[model samples]
Structure formats: structure tokens, C-alpha cells
Target: MGDRRLAIEAWESLFRAQHEVFGKLSGDFVGSDLSQAEYDVLLTVTRAPDMTARLRDVTANMLISQPSVSRLVDRMVGRGLVTKCSDPDDGRGALVTATEEGAHAFRVIGAAHGRSIAEHMACFDDEELRTLLTLTEKLRGYRSGE
Candidate 1:
């Protein structure tokens, strides 16, 4: 078993670092055409095949609730950021596709956001980054031995 005090200290350090980095990175959205959450949505949608993805899939990547995501998508549809249509594969599901304008916006914001992320993470070298990635993935059950 792990040492409880050491585990708690590690968790606190990780949480605080994430919070600070995220706070700094959130500035990338200020005065931009897209908000941070919208960028997150596009981050998932833009990577999908043909820039289209199931609404459920997008929601899976988001930290919000399904209803909240649905509402956000509706808002994006109104802004010409994306289009929503019924999913052929799932009767109850919807599909979201990034518009030309939306894709362009995502690329613009994504570039700067990428830079900001790199700047914030610059304190860690490549090997340390790899370790951080491995540990975080493990925490999320992603790197668990299959």
C-alpha cells in the first residue's frame, strides 16, 4: 500500500499545478471569436472524420452534461459554427459537423492555444513530460495494464 500522507501531498501538488496552468491558458480565448468551451467542442469535432462527429462522442470529451452540450451545440448552430443533424446510425443521436468558418476559427485559436500550452509546459523537459503524461493517463485508467 502507498503512504497516505505522501499520496495526499502528490495529489495536492498535481491539482494545484493543473489549476494554475489552466488559469493561464484560459486567456487564449479572451477577445477571440470562440470561447474556451467552444474551442474544446471544436477540438473534438475538428479531429473527427470529415469534421463530423456524433454528439455523444463530443459530449464524451467535454466536462459538461449532455443537456448542456446539446444546448451549446444549438447555440453554435445558430452562430454558423457547426451544423447538427440526426445521426443515421443512432436514432436518438445527433451528428455535429464543423462549418468552413468554424473550422477556420478553430485553426486560428488552436494555433495560439497550442503555443500557450507549450509555453506553460515549458518548465518540464521531454522526459518529464512523458512521465507526466503516463502518470495522468494512469490516474484516468487509460494507461492501466490491459
Candidate 2:
């Protein structure tokens, strides 16, 4: 019973921390060309080879639903931020590639966002940050069977 209580406490703390941090970070996107969701998509796509990634891969990395991602991608395509093409290796799949314009916008916002994140995270010391990273990775890895 004590262990279960402790686990619940830990989970609540983690959830609250994430919510607070995300709420603060969301402000960083104001006046940018992208929403936080769009920036997240670009982050994944820009890091992939040739600045392109499979739609499924992007969906897997995102926190949103597949249909939501599809809609967002369509909107981005219309905005000329990304291009969608039939995946060469999978006829049924689509590939998303960040356009040069998209990459430039990402770079612009990403730099400022990075600084904003660092500022918000400044409360954590290096050792605490390392431990937090390790614990979060362990939790995620366990769920992912990694």
C-alpha cells in the first residue's frame, strides 16, 4: 500500500511538472509561423534523412492522433511549409519533406525556443537534469520494450 501510494505521488508530480513546463513553453511560439504541433512535426522531419520522413514515423513521434497529424500535414502542405509525396518504398504510404522555407522557419523559431526552454529549465542543476533525463528515458523505454 505504501509503495502504491508512492508511485501515485510520483506520477502526479511528473504530470504536473510536464503540464506547467509545457504551458510556459507554449508562449515561445507566439508570433512564429508555426504552432507547437507544427513545430513538433518539423522537428522530426528536419532531423530525418534528406529532411524527409514517412508520415507514419512522424505520427509515431507525435503526441496527437494519426488523423490529426494527417490534417495538420495537409494544412502545412497548403502553406508551402512541407510537401507530401507517395513513399517510394511503400506505395500506400506518404512521405513528408520539409521545404527550404519550412527549414528556415524552423531554424528561426527553434533557436528562440531553445533559449526559452533553457531559461525555464534553469532551476534544475546539471546533476538533477541528468537524473531526470535518465528516469524519463527509463520509463519510456520500459513502455516501448526497449
Whole-model lDDT values for every prediction: 0.94, 0.95
lDDT of 1 at 70: 95
List CA RMSD, all candidates: 1.0, 1.9
lDDT of 1 by residue, 29-83 (tens): 9999999989988999999999999999999999899999999999999999999
Q: Which candidate number maximizes TM-score?
A: 1
RMSD of 2: 1.9
With a 3 Å backbone cut-off (N, CA, C), the pairs that clash in candidate 1 are none
Candidate 1 displacement at residue 141 in angstroms:
0.9
User: Which runs of model 1 end up more than 4 angstroms from their true locations?
Assistant: 144-146
Candidate 1 global lDDT: 0.94
For each candidate in turn, the TM-score is 0.97, 0.94
Model 2, span 1-146: residue lDDT tens: 56998999999999999999999999999888999999999999999999999999999999999999999999999999999999989999999999999999999999999999999889999999999888999978853656
Residue pair clashes in candidate 2:
none
